[model samples]
Target: MSKAEKTKQFIIEKTASLFNTKGYLSTTLSDIAQATHLTKGSIYGNFANKDELAIEVYKYNSGLLSKSMSRSFGDEFPTTMDKLHAFVDFYRKNWRSVFSNGGCPLMNAATESDDIFPGLKNQVKKSFEDWAGKISSVIIQGQKNGDLNEKANAEEYASIFIMLLEGGILLSKTTGDEKFLNLALERITKMIDNELNILPS
Candidate 1:
């Protein structure tokens, strides 16, 4: 990476949490300068403006989450059921760590960007679509392999899972409790076992 690229990434890393916790509209160039210990000139040199920097920061934060989820289910799970279970398990164990870092970046950005930040709304939408695509791919592959019920709609299941998980995160974060997320995971697991998984015939 060039010096400019490194500097841009450094700024993104430093202010990612700030953007997630405080928000895009609320955060300012001065706040970023304070976080990165760089002058506004330096920041502007690296990024066109605060809006560009915020979008990059959102990508950086959300990429970490995407990679984390990928790692959780990557190679360890051989079967579709196992992969789905691992998906739920990842949140069950890592929700606190995720929350400590300012909750889910996708959720934070979605709520903050919608109808407010036009520049970021499209990016957030792409992130969500990509997430759903990953889960739907798993289910689609399972159906093709006869590991899951063919009747199950992969796209619908993917959407439902995301909704439940995000809703759970919102509720859990709001109430300062884990039960809401746990309950959501419980439902996901049950849905996988009862509704999606294929029985020996």
Candidate 2:
């Protein structure tokens, strides 16, 4: 890789957590400079402005999260039900790591960018759409395999699942109680077993 590209990536990696924790508006170029050990001129040399840098940082943070999840839901989880369970397990097991890293990047960006940064907000919206698409795809596969009920609405279930999980994250983070997330996971498990799981004839 080119030196310039490496430098840019270094800046993104350094500032990603800062942006996730302090947020876009609150995180300044000075803070980024301090975090990256780069001069303001260097930062600007890579990014056109703070807005551009923030957008890239959001992508970097989100990409890391997606990669972690993908790693958790590996090829060993062949069945859709297995994959879904793994998804829950991933969050449950990694909650502490996530909390220490400043919470879910997608959630942080969505909540912080809305009504403020239109570009960033739209990016968050696209991120949600992409996430829902993945979940819905899994639901459709489950139905095809008779692992999940054909009567279930894939999109609707996906939306509910995301809402419950994200809401649980928010509540758990706010209250410093993992029980809130566990409760949400319990509900999801019931939903999968009772609502989506296909019954034997």
Candidate 3:
């Protein structure tokens, strides 16, 4: 990569956590400058403006999160149920990392951009749609493989999983306790076992 591209990436990397933790509206240009040790002009040169940078930062943070989850699942799990379980397990085992990085980027951006920063709403919306798509795809695969109920609604199941997980994240982060998320994950596992799993005759 060229020096300019590297600098742009460096700025994005350095400030991703800052934007996630501090928030897009509350985070100032000076804050980003301090975080990256670059002047406001340098930051502007790399990004058209603060709004543009915020969008890029959100993408960067979300991308990292996606990569982590993909790694957790890896290629070892051949079955759909295994992947779903791994999805829940990913949150259970990595809640700390998620929280430390300022909670899930989707949740953070969704709340903030819903009203405060309308500019980012589209990107955040796309991110959620993509996330749900991944989950639903897994369910569809399971149905094809006869590992999950053929009648099951993949989209519905995906929505439920996301709602439970995101709700768990919000509650746990608010209460400073992990029980909320634990309870949510427990419910999800039970749902998989009882509602979705297809037992052999």
lDDT by residue (tens digit), candidate 1, 116-139: 898899999999999999999999
Tens digits of per-residue lDDT, candidate 3, 38-84, equal: 99999999999899999999999888888877664567887888898
Per-candidate TM vs. native? 0.97, 0.96, 0.96
C-alpha lDDT (0 to 100) for residue 57 of candidate 2: 91
Best by lDDT: 1
lDDT of 2 at 110: 92
Poorest lDDT segment (10 consecutive residues) of candidate 3: 66-75
lDDT accuracy of residue 159 in candidate 3: 91
Q: Residue 133: error of model 1 in Å?
A: 0.5
**Weakest ten-residue segment in model 1 by summed lDDT:** 67-76
Off by over 4 Å in 3: none
Identify the leading candidate in terms of TM-score. 1
Q: How many clashes show up per model? A: 0, 0, 0
Candidate 2, residue 115: how far the Cα is off, in Å? 2.5
What lDDT score is found at residue 100 in candidate 1?
Answer: 87
